[model samples]
Target: MTNEQFIERLQQPNWSVSCKTEQQVDLVLQACRTAGISSDKREEIIKVLRLPIDIGFSKYFDTIEYAHNGAFKFLELENITSWFFDAIKKE
Candidate 1:
């Protein structure tokens, strides 16, 4: 997906679990891993990302907000996008 598409999807309020949403989560996590994000930091990201959607969909918004706010300190937006696209291509 294009970065704009990715961002648009992320901003959507729906956090219902589906094959596509699961794939999106996997892509984000894989991107982080491929970029050599530290395990501890990845775990932290995971914790935020995995928060239950049933609990008001906070986790979905929170994860996107965290990424926008520089949770992955070493990664540039371009790098994150690149990693995400690479992960998608690999799948």
Candidate 2:
């Protein structure tokens, strides 16, 4: 789905599970850990991404993973700002 569509879906939470989606979430989480983003930073990224907070933080990772499934690549401090802007863009 497009970023706009993903943002729209994020407004309403859902609980359906997909194995691939879970894997993607895990991938992102692991990347963050490897990059030393810190737990607080990870949580903040989730918040910045506008993911669901009702679910535990672990589960919150899934929101952005599913929303940007095929889009995320290697993340670094230098590129993260632009990446976040791109991910949250309305159009």
Extract clashing residue pairs from model 2. none
The TM-score obtained by model 1 is 0.30
List the candidate 2 regions with Cα displacement exceeding 4 Å.
Answer: 1-20, 40-91
- Mark the regions of model 1 whose C-alpha exceeds 4 Å error after superposition: 1-20, 44-83
Worst 10 residues of 1 by lDDT: 51-60
Model 1 per-residue lDDT tens digits across residues 1-91: 5655654443444232211244555555544344333255544554455432111122333433233333333432222344345536755
- Per-candidate Cα lDDT values, in order, are 0.38, 0.35
TM-score of every prediction relative to native = 0.30, 0.25
TM-score of 2: 0.25
Backbone clashes, each candidate:
0, 0
Name the lDDT value of residue 16 in candidate 1: 28
